[model samples]
Target: MKKEYAVIGLGRFGGSICKALSEEGLEVMAMDMNEDRVNEYAKIASHAVIGDSTDESVLKNLGIRNFDHVIVAIGENIQASILTTIMLKELGVKMVTVKAQNDYHEKVLNKIGADRIVHPERDMGRRIAHKIISNNVLDYLELSDEYSLIEIVANSRLAGHSLLDLDIRARYGINIVAIKRGKEVIVSPLADEMIQKEDILIVIGAVADIGRFEKREMQNDY
Candidate 1:
């Protein structure tokens, strides 16, 4: 079944998510106080409206509670964000995801029962730092504060080694969940499957363990 979503902001952060969700063919409504921003997303969402989301009457009229998820991506205006979130929860929204402008904003959102809080700048910084630390790191995704999923390009030193040879899980405390070789992906790779240089390894583990594994395994002399 397709889920319904409503994005309550048309700023850069909110716009990107609205577009991505639309591209996936999901039913999404984009809302904002800016007439121009709502006009811009008219064709990108199932519906686009210019209105103040903190207004309970506007939300009730739009039947906001029926949507599966609501994303409060309002920018800068922390008070409006908080008010809108409180109204959504009060109206019985199934899930609420909010963008935090700072640590204090996140704490407030948490206390108000937001299901998820995203810090775009901080997460992007972590990804950039990982890329700077090693050329092998292709991408980084934080599963939580402690764990992450990372994509690493296999170096020549890892070419001939099979899963059993390296004992990756036992040695590095990480699991190579999948291997992407060109257009092919091997999921849950067998212990005997030998790795080839340049294969993209999708790994997940504790952040500290991944740093140690990358330092000792990926940064060593060939």
Candidate 2:
């Protein structure tokens, strides 16, 4: 069965989520205070409505509690975001995801029982910065404040070496979880497997360790 979703504040983040869910043939109701924004998503989302989610009555009228998941993507307005999240939880929405502006806002959302708090802008900035600083780093995903998963293009230095020879876990305190070569992906790669130049290494480790490995090993080769 397709899960139903209600997305409040039809901003970039919310609109994108709505569009993706609709593309997957899920039921999605997009809402925003601005009629213009609601109108824009009417053709894309299953339903689009102009209403203030901060008001419990408005949410009730929209049948928001019936949705399986609700996303509070109210941009800039922290108060409305908090109120809506709280109301959704109180009304027994199965899940509530919210976009937090900063650390303080995130703390408040956490206290108010938001199922997930996303810092999209801040996370995107970090990913872009990593890619800009090193040609080897293709992508970065923060698993936590200290740990991250990174995709690095294997350089000449890494080529012709097996995982056993590199002893990457012992030396760098990181793990090569997978290797992507061309269209093939080798997950949980064996220790005897050799790395080839341009092979994409999917590594996971502490942020500091990953940084050190990239700077001392990958970047220095070029």
- Worst 10 contiguous positions by lDDT, candidate 1: 212-221
How do the residues 1-222 of candidate 1 rate in per-residue lDDT, one tens digit apiece? 899999999999999999999999999999999999999999899999999998999999999999999999999999999999999999999899999999999999999999999998889999999999999999999999899999999998788999999898999899999999999999999999999999999999999999999999888849
lDDT of each: 0.96, 0.94
Model 2 residue 59 distance off true place after TM-score fit, in angstroms: 1.0
Candidate 2 residue-wise lDDT at 47? 95
The lDDT of model 1 is 0.96
RMSD of each: 1.4, 0.9
Candidate 1 ranges beyond 4 A from true positions? none
TM-score of each: 0.94, 0.97
